[model samples]
Target: MKITVIGTGYVGLVAGACFADIGNEVWCVDVDQTKIDKLKQGIIPIYEKGLEPIVNKNFQEGRLHFSTNLLDGFDQSQFIFIAVGTPSNPDGSVDLKYVYAVAEEIAKNLKDYKLIINKSTVPVGTGKQLRDFIDQKIKERGINVDFDIVSNPEFLREGNAIEDFMNPDRVIIGTESIRAKEQMNELYSGLFKDAEPRIIFMDVRSAEVTKYASNSMLATKISFINEISNLCEKVDANVEMVRLGVGADKRIGYSFISPGIGYGGSCFPKDVKAIINTGNEYGYDMKLLKAVELINETQKAHLFDKIQNYFDNKKDGLKGKTIAIWGLAFKPETDDMRESPSQVIIRKLVEGGTKIKAHDPEAQNEAKRLFKDIETSIEYFDDNYECLKDCDALALLTEWNIYKQPNFQLIKKHLKNPIIFDGRNQYRPSEMKEMGFDYFSIGR
Candidate 1:
């Protein structure tokens, strides 16, 4: 199968690379010439585990192609994937200009039958809208061509996108046409050959809703656990123990129930907001999700509150304090910092006259760019221990694997005091007490 993936963003690039790796010729088209140039030379922009090797391999084997011209892919492939970004608007609605623009361009260039599959996360009924838009555009040009729209929302986790793509538990494809289903099945058959993958066929609207509902549910679980963690602190209980006890339930099986400062990533925040806005537009109240969103927003400040209260009362509060942050990325194995909790915490700390010394395995570059406005108040370090040097205390934000079991001796020797504020609950509180260090962790 020959496929074209437009907009070489995270979803598009990963899908294109994985498609090519599966023995399909894939052309990844983007408008950014600089990005296309870099991809051609095997210079990946984003960091993901096991993505670079696959991309480079497929590109070197001539199965994968990178080009700035949309026509390059448009001319070669019958399956065209709309993988552009649908970022959130100020009112929380998904901005569909990118997807619509791509569709119009495809319509203008349409001369034959093509399967226009959507890999971007979009609101429900987007397939119909695009179908109508393309039809109108094509009629305006006085050319008749056949094109079918298919909604195939992505469920790729940022850190593990490649693995998710290769071993998807289920692939939800929405198209009423048997022709569309048959063609899509052919394209994905090889990818699902070894596994018992469920390729569900449903109506387009239902398929679109699945993506938002899935992300919102995961976000709810996270916020529910964080809310419970906050209560645990008041009731003198440990969230980790509660999580263990609660997760033992066969139905509730632990996944996104880890109590943390908050859930921050490109998908969760955006999807949750979009769904809530969708509900509002339809005159329905998403009451539960509203609470979930509120909980998450407040939870972003929980760790910072712990830091402030730990130093403020008898001391100068957060003013004139230097805090060392162990991680800056939303989660490990990727450098994406969009909607990162570190942003809210670090910004507030900087506003209060406190300095931040941060270190992450891969996110320092992104963090530097994100916090450039406050560059004077923050210092990034190559070494985690070096970041703690001369700082008042240590705060762990992201749970990168390396920070789980760190050099405690070095942490103690480097910081001004043997104090640690852990947000991810990476360490056992009992052990911190035994090690002669003042440790503060959530829900403990």
Candidate 2:
């Protein structure tokens, strides 16, 4: 199958590479000439695990190609996937400019019957709107052609996008056309041959709603656990133990139960807001989701307050303090900093005139670009422990493995004070106390 994936962003690049790796001829279309040129030279823009090698192999084998010209991609492919970003607008609606632009371009260049798949997470009824827009445009041009618009939203998480794509738990196809369904199933059958990932079939609107609902559920679990963790701390209980007790029930299960600063990435924040906006448009309120959003916001701020309150009624005490941040990425294994709690925590500390020495196994350089304005305020370290040297205290913002079971002896020896604030609950409070280090964690 010849497939063209428009918008070579995180989702597009990973989908394109994986499709090509599975023997489909893929042409990745992006408007950015520089990005396409770099990709042509084996340069990948994003830092996703196992992506570069797969992309290189596919390109070398003539299975994958990169292009800046949409027409070239359109002319050579039977299936066109719009994998562009639909960022959240100020009103919480998904900004569909990029997706619409790609759809319009595909409409203009429709030479034959093609299967148009929407792989970007979009609002319900977007597929119908896109189909109408394309059909109307083609009619205006006096060209009678047929194309099937199918909703196939992606559920890949960052830092593990390749693995998720290669071994998805399920494949969803939302289309009314039987021909389109057959073609879609054929496209993915080879990928899930033996594992037999369940292929879910539904209406287009249901498929769109599924993506938002899935992320919203995950976000709700995070906020729910965080709320419980807060209560556990107040009542002198351990959230980890509570999580273990509840997760033992086969019905409850135990994923996304860790009490963290908050959930942040490209998906959850935007999708929750978008779904809330959708409810508002339909004259119904998503009260629980609204609370979930509020909880996440409060969780991000709580980390800041924890550090300030630890200083305990002392003004300007943090002014000259040097704090070491162990992780800067939103999570481990990816360099994405979008909506990262590290941003909020670091920004607050910097405002209080505290110097910061941050280190991540892979996100250091990305952090440099993110905090470009703070020239004299922050320093990046390649070695995680090196950041602890001469620092007043350490803040574990993201749970990177190197910082998990560290040489506590070295940390105690190097820091100006043996104090640590762990936002991720990566360390045990009782053990840190026994080690003679002042420790603060989310909920025990």
Candidate 3:
């Protein structure tokens, strides 16, 4: 199969590389000439685990290609995937300019029957709109060409994207065209051969809504647990124990239940807002989702408030204090800092006249870029221990594996006060108290 994936961002690059790895000839198209040139030279633009090696291998094996010209592989490609970004607007609506632009380009270059798959996360009814848009463009061009639109939204997690792409929990195919469905089945047959068939066939609108609903549900879980954690704090109860009791039920498996600052990434925050906006657009208010969004926003500031209270207890405010941030990325094993809690915490601390030293295994450079305006107030360090030197307290933001179990002695020796704020609840309160250090954690 010959496949062309437009927009070489996270989704496009991963999908293209994985398809090529499965023996399909894939061409990744992007308008940016510099990005295309870098891809040709085996330079990956993003950090996804196990992606670079597979992309390089596929490119070297002649199964993968990158180009700036969208028409370069259109004639030969049987399937073209629009995997562009649909970032959120100020009102939380999705900006579909890129997706629509790609559709127009494909319509102009369509030479044969092709399956146009919407691999980007989009609003419901986008497939129908895209089909109509392309048909209108073709009519104006006085060309008769057939194309089927399929909504095949991606479910790849950032840190584990390659694994998710290769071994997805389920593959969704949303199209009414039997011809398009047949091609999609054949294309994915090799990947799903060993596992039980998990391909879900649904209507286009249902498929589009599934992506947003899935993220929104997960975000709700995070907010639910955060709310519980807040109550636990007020009632003098431990959230860890409550979580254990609640999660012990087989019906409620423990995932995304850990109380943290909040959920942050490209997906959760954006998808929740998008879904809420979608509901409002249809004259139905998503009251539960609105509360979920509010809780997450409040949770992002929870850790900063904890820090301020800790200093206030000592009769020395956060002013002139230096705090060490152990993690800058939203989560571990990826350098994505979009909507990271560390940004919220650090920004508030800086505004309060507090200094920061932050470190992350992969996100230090990204942290520098994100916090460039406050360069004078914050420092980036490669070593976590170095970040703690002379700091008032250590605020563990992202739960990186390296920061899980460190030299507590070294942390105690370096910090001016032996205090730790564990946003992710990575440390046990009893253990921290036994170690003779003041410990603060989320709901425990």
RMSD of each: 1.0, 1.3, 1.1
Best by lDDT: 3
Considering only N, C-alpha and C atoms within 3 Å, which residue pairs clash in candidate 1?
312-317
lDDT by residue (272-298, candidate 3, tens digit) is: 999999999999999999999999999
How would you encode candidate 2's per-residue C-alpha lDDT over 1-444 as one tens digit per residue?
Answer: 999999998999999999999999999999989989999999988889999999999999999999998877677798999999999999999999999999889988998999999999999999999999999999999989999999999999898999899889888899999999989989998688863357888899999999999999999999999999999989999999999998888887899889989999889999999999999999999999999999999999787787777765555467788999999889998889888989989999999888999988888887898899995899988888888999988999999788889999999998988999999888888899999998988876
Q: Write the per-residue lDDT of candidate 1 for residues 311-414, one digit (tens) a residue.
A: 88657788899999999999888899999999999998888889999999999999889998999999989988899999999999999999999989899999
The TM-score measured for candidate 1 stands at 0.98
| lDDT of every model, 2 decimals | 0.92, 0.91, 0.93
Which consecutive 10 residues in model 2 have the weakest lDDT in total? 309-318
Decreasing TM-score order of the candidates? 1, 3, 2
> Model 1: C-alpha RMSD to truth?
1.0
TM agreement with the true structure for every prediction: 0.98, 0.97, 0.98
Cα lDDT of model 1 overall?
A: 0.92
TM-score-best of 1 and 2? 1
Q: How well does model 3 score by local distance difference test?
A: 0.93
